[model samples]
Target: MRAAWAIYKRELVGTFCSPLAYAVMVSFLLFNGVVFYFFMDLVASNPSLSGTRGPLQLFFGSTILSVLTLMIFCPATTMRAFAEEWRSRTAETLLTAPVTDLQVVLAKFMGSMTLYAALWVPTLLYALVVRRYGAVDWGALSAAYAGVMLVGGAFVSIGLLASSLAASQVTAFVTSFGVIGGAMFALGLGRYVFTEESQLRFFSYVNLWEHMEHFAVGMMDSRQVVYYGSVVVLALSLTVRALAARREA
Candidate 1:
């Protein structure tokens, strides 16, 4: 546990020291601001939507922005998780250390999640500003934030798994995006193609959008929680296994 914390601190400090983190933070805030402003403009032109100023709109708007933000930044953030260690010949050092493979992977995962949460702080300011001028549903907003964090965890896990498989940073980034993009597309297509009466609802349950909808509407669904939790476990478990294999090799 101590060793894991050491790795976590190292990763966190390393991430903050790099210009990449700053670039990602700026890009996220700018993209979110532009999207939110556009949404506000659209609402202004259509008064009916304007009156709907609760957390639901804010959440839905933020979810779209978060997806885009994660898609762009997660790869960059995770690309170095294993690929750089391999490139620098540091993997052997970490692998031969007293830490277990699980600890190493978990440390990296937690570090990435910490960075992601930091990136999300500025969005809270935007939410507060919206609340000052418009009606806000605090309960719904809280739930939505929880959902966003949950989805972010899942994405980070997927990215880490990709990083484990990749031989290079670029490969890790592309592979992470490919996996995430495919899952997202499959989830959307499943909703349209699957019959309402079919048992495919079980399969669609894996979709981040489906799980997130419950929280966006202020409902805390245990099923959705389990789904997201399963995703985290599955991805992390695979990551541990991948690292173990690398160590043995």
Candidate 2:
């Protein structure tokens, strides 16, 4: 446990010190700022708008915005997890340092999640900013944050596994992106590809966009929670095994 903690602290410090992390954070905030401004401005200028939803809902809705954010930042944050260690020949030193593979994987997963959380931390101000012009739904915004964290657990673990499997950082990033994007797209196809209602319902359970959309409106469905929870566990388990294989090789 001490070893794991040490590794976690080291990785977190490394991430915080990296120019890449700062660049990614700044880029994420800028992109979200533009999106928020556009949505809020639209709401203010258009008086004929329906009372169906708020800017927060649209921000977290089943659009390409969240997806784009994940696509860019998650990979940039995680692509170097184990890949850089292997590249620099430091992985063997750590793997042989009287630490279990599980601990190592957990440390990396957690370190990446810390960086991931920092990426989203700036968006909290969006609520306060919007409060100036409109009433913010605190309940739904809370749910949205929970939903993002839940999905990030799985997404970061998946990226960690990709890093463990790849020998280079670029390859790891591309692999992780492909895995995450392909899984999302494949699950979404269930709505159009399936004829049976029951089958479609199963597919809907794993649809990342729909899951977040549900959270955006303040509904925390148990099925979606279990889906993401399972993904996080499964991905991390595979990552541990992958790292073990690399260590033993």
TM-score of each: 0.91, 0.95
Residue-wise C-alpha lDDT for candidate 1, range 1-249, written one tens digit per residue? 999999999998888998878887898778878877776666657777655444346445335554666676776678778887888889989889889889999999998888888887777776677767676777877887787787778888988999997899889999988888788535655765767656467556665555566666566677777876888899999999998787678
**Range of the 10 consecutive residues with the lowest summed lDDT in candidate 2:** 46-55
Task: For model 1, give the RMSD to the true fold.
Answer: 2.2
Report the number of the highest-lDDT candidate.
2
Against the true structure, candidate 2 reaches a TM-score of 0.95
- Candidate 2: what lDDT? 0.84
User: Which regions of candidate 1 are displaced past 4 Å?
Assistant: 51-66
lDDT of 2 by residue, 142-223 (tens): 9988988888888888899999989898999999889888885467668777879898888877777777788888889788
* Model 2: colliding residue pairs: none
Model 2, runs deviating above 4 Å? 48-50
